[model samples]
Target: MKKSLSLILGLSLCALCVGTSFSQAAATQTVNLAVNSVQKIAITGGVITLTISNGTAGNNTLTPVSDATSTYSITHNSATPLRITANLDAALAAGYQLQIALAPGALMGTSAGTVDISNALAASAVAVVTGIPKGADAGRTITYTFNANASAGILTSTAKTVTLTLTN
Candidate 1:
């Protein structure tokens, strides 16, 4: 069964928790949007983080590219996703081109962006998920995972952050 990882972004916050529940009828089960803002944060600088992790067994792809309907959401708590993934390829793969969308209104680092650690595979990357969202932080470090397959284990970070600097 495919699992989901939830993220609470826009602040110096802890990692987001994600999960998945499969229904026998889920194959054809019509799903809807259910959002709960457990927290919120303002963009003080061109930097934000979303601590995220893969579900058990390290299988984090909510749905396979082959199946496009597989859907998931990244809850920003106080802020919105900026539809960052708005520019992401619906289906991600190994060595495939990624359009990683930074929050539309949110700049690369300030309003909204991500620090790439493909070369510096963090705890999350080592876990084995192919792709990750932006501004992913845990404590003092915000990192994102990339497609680190057996052939290429070291991915490089574009280190794209909010396009502009921010002032709370």
Candidate 2:
């Protein structure tokens, strides 16, 4: 009879120890929702729109970035770089210099968290900020001037409908 009693006590003690161990483990970690991974994609023939005021005009020779070549894209890699180019209509008597630069803030893109430019480009990319570095021609486009082979490494995006916003 004593052996039977001792066996029951031993089993009860084992059960208590297991229950305490499980409860202690559960207290340390917080339960969380499962995380989902995202894949990124790119598009072609993205739109480039300009809304410059006459104020943007300078030297009585404000050269506009031709719609033909005013386009940019992010090439994904360990460090994704941007491909931005532009053209000026006429060369200035002074021999102009045109360059690429990021705009002040995010422009409106059809996609989210972005006003303009691809979110990947925007998130991973940067703005021109008027006085900051990153553009080809700093202030304005010089007539008959051309600047090419400019690149900028931006963050990355995971949305479609990328748009580009450039400024003087």
Candidate 3:
């Protein structure tokens, strides 16, 4: 009887160990993600000087002077197209004209070439770039032209503020 009881106890313990080894537990979780629209623009150079000191002989019109040393950059992620406009803080004096040109990336937008901003105002801004796509454009050229007719005569050194806007 004692031998038989010991054998039964050993078999029960082995079965318990086998059952525990086959058991398993598990866990789970959820995750989410998202992104937003963004837009930005910047200029790289400052204090460009344009002088009209020379003129063709017997020509009543003074030669126009230009400067293309400045550049602009942009980064945007918008669903729709966009544009860039330019204006001056105040209208230039009569007979003096200031023009601006912007070079867009090959795939970014259409360059308006050069547009005269001499009288452009906040309410009536001039468009310099149009049909801009969603991407980044770096090191784009910006050209400025200054012109004065002979009748306008010599102008004292003056300063003007140019405002460039990126919008839809």
Candidate 4:
């Protein structure tokens, strides 16, 4: 009887051990992602339509005038700072120069509307502004003035192209 009781106790303990509840802990994991950076610039209303007054019959010159204005927009989505510049693809007529100015309160890449790029050349890029922040669109209007010296030679009613290039 003693041996049988011991066997039964041992069996009961084994069963209890097999039925024991297990302690569990939840596991977690993390994932990370990133987006690519981009920097872009665009110009609208780039065409300059000019209507100049006629020169005096004896004077071979056209008066200086603000011919046209164009708007430039900078869409800076880059992670680094940016700058803007303007240059003319071709030189104006001899003794002539094209003047560019930013609006008084206009916003630039870094400054507030204070830029004048004169006698710009395709080989040289004039700094318009710097420090454009990263984000959406920022716009500025640039006014162009055409100046002609008295010795500019005989004037003709013809189309002259002065390309203004904007660069980052």
Instruction: Report every candidate's CA lDDT.
Output: 0.28, 0.32, 0.90, 0.60
Question: What TM-score against the true fold does each predicted structure earn?
Answer: 0.17, 0.22, 0.80, 0.59
lDDT of 1 by residue, 101-159 (tens): 12322222332344332222222221111122233422122223333233323334334
> Which is better, 3 or 4, measured by TM-score?
3
Candidate 2 backbone clash number: 23
Which sections of candidate 4 miss by over 4 Å?
1-34, 54-62, 104-119, 155-168
Tens-place lDDT digits, model 2, residues 1-168: 999999999999999999998887634667899744322222233444432222232343343333333323322221222233232233222322233333222331111211122222433433422222232322221111122111222213212233333322
Candidate 4 TM-score versus the reference: 0.59
**Comparing 2 and 4 on TM-score, the stronger one:** 4
Query: Clashes per prediction?
Result: 17, 23, 0, 1
Error of 2 at 104 (Å): 12
Candidate 2, superposed: residue stretches over 4 Å from native: 21-78, 87-168
Report the number of the highest-lDDT candidate.
3
- What's the ranking of the predictions by lDDT, best on top? 3, 4, 2, 1
